[model samples]
Target: MASSGSAEVERDLTRDIRLEVSSSNRSSCQVCKEKIEKDSIRVAHPSRSSNVSIMKYVHPSCYLSSCVHFENSKCKSKCRLSKHEIGKHELRLTMALTSCEGKLKDQVFFHPPHASTLVRQLLDAAGGTEHTFDQLCVSLPQDAKAWARDALSGVDLTGRRAPTVEPEVKPRAPKKKRAAEDDEAESAAKKPRAKKAKASSEYFVEDGDPFCDGDQNDGDAELVD
Candidate 1:
């Protein structure tokens, strides 16, 4: 009856706590992407960009690790962010160029990926059949991750994609430092130009051949005669 039930209830509570403690044990190293069982550590929220796939699980440590690169910088380098709000607007500038030079000149970077490991998660999330990456891009928009998912659904195979770029064809070579120095010197030699003159260019006459005028020729002949 109620006599020993109190003790039994306490025992049941103890067992439940122990089981929960054991069940939640996971020892995955988020940074290195390794799993450890006994020495498992709990990672808090990580610094993963929204531009990634859901399948790409980073330990809280791993995700937070890369945020320094992603955060807005006052004088940032070229990346997700930059000095003058480079990445502030967050636009993905993509261009297709077959030649390596063209791609390089355009600063375009392209990489492929693994099918089974990298893409399946993205495809599964997007609800696209495994062959509609480009078509789905319209609705999905700019996330690298969404694009990756679309690509996964579209491609038959996957692995780390290689980077192949068309080199940019420079209409002109980058101005050499030495040549720039010369230009600087020339500019320094000349005084800074005054502000735009109020007078129209009409003040400055064009080069004209005085001899071309019939009146000048006739006057010369008469003088010679």
Candidate 2:
């Protein structure tokens, strides 16, 4: 059982709308029509990396089979839904519900941030919305607490709450120096310094180019020799 404080924190942190409906539509997943919604569930998967889907709810049965991180023969239950979302999809799976006056507003899906926008668009094509973040985080799912525990690797859920922000403090302005003295200092600093050393005035005596055999000597000195 979660404490009242942690419970509220968990709710706020994971607030999202979740729904369970019995659709006689019997529609198999459009991605794979092999299974029917009557016996299967439909869910959203992010089309690309790092972008979450909004209102793109996935089906329960479909999720178990088609998850990218589908494991064989170990854990095959609906309880592992959050695990699939966190582990398989770089996107998160949040069950945030919207509300007006702290009451039911609507139900929607939240994909992980890493998933592409197109995934959400695809979901919207079927069933989705464009609700804002504040509109979200109202009705979070219970799954988030457990999944956060497992995925977050056991960070304490105790005492987690909405952060109380403090008022901002502005910095003080810099002091102005005395004008006459500052000007004198500035002018003195800007004066150029004397040269440290002059380059050597000596120049090397030239020899005939040795690159060509035609002129192998220094200006025909070898020819004279």
Candidate 3:
């Protein structure tokens, strides 16, 4: 009975978030919907429902982008490093500080650069120099693991929030202006040129010869009564 109880406890412990290398390529990442290749690093979030445990795996970067980082979260308090009030709508990094029951008891907000520094301090306290980033992430507290990975990796969280929709600036229509110009051009093209009337003494002539009056010759040759 003691051995059986120990095995059950071990199984229960495995149903938690894990950072590890993939053993097979069969599992697809929940965030990007891509196959996790064998030997690649992956993040797993495990959940139990109706006595069955299910594990969802994602790539490290995908997991950081999808879960760990935020852009539009309002700051509720001062930054941990600067001790200045974070503006209500200002962009900030959020790290949840959870209780032993894994219930979130509080949150720590920081500027992006300051968040990185805090993560490094935590890592140094944990003797993180000897371990790779993945190993250090695994050693962090459960609540800190995701954000720690994000901070260390320098993931940009500025664009992850729900996008603000700006009012569309409809382009000004040029049809009215273009139509006015076209009307002016058409009027100019169709306008008649006024010619000064010539005196009767100026007979119509051929080849600029005033004496060679073709109209007078044709009229004089007409039959008379």
Largest lDDT belongs to which candidate?
A: 3
Q: Among all windows of ten consecutive residues in candidate 2, which has the lowest summed lDDT?
A: 68-77
Per residue, candidate 1 scores C-alpha lDDT tens digits across 40-140 of: 33223212246541222233333223211111122212421111223322322221112224221122111222222222333333243533444323433
Given candidate 1, what's the lDDT at residue 224? 41
For model 1, the run of ten residues with the poorest summed lDDT: 15-24
Q: What C-alpha lDDT do the candidate models reach, one value each?
A: 0.34, 0.36, 0.58
TM-score on alpha carbons, each prediction: 0.22, 0.21, 0.32
lDDT accuracy of residue 20 in candidate 2: 35
**RMSD in Å for model 1:** 23.0
lDDT of each residue in 95-213, candidate 3, tens digit only: 54233475632344665545565444444433424534465456444555565466556676564431222345899877988999999999999999899987688446467575764
Full-model lDDT, candidate 1:
0.34
lDDT of 3: 0.58
Model 1 scores a TM of: 0.22
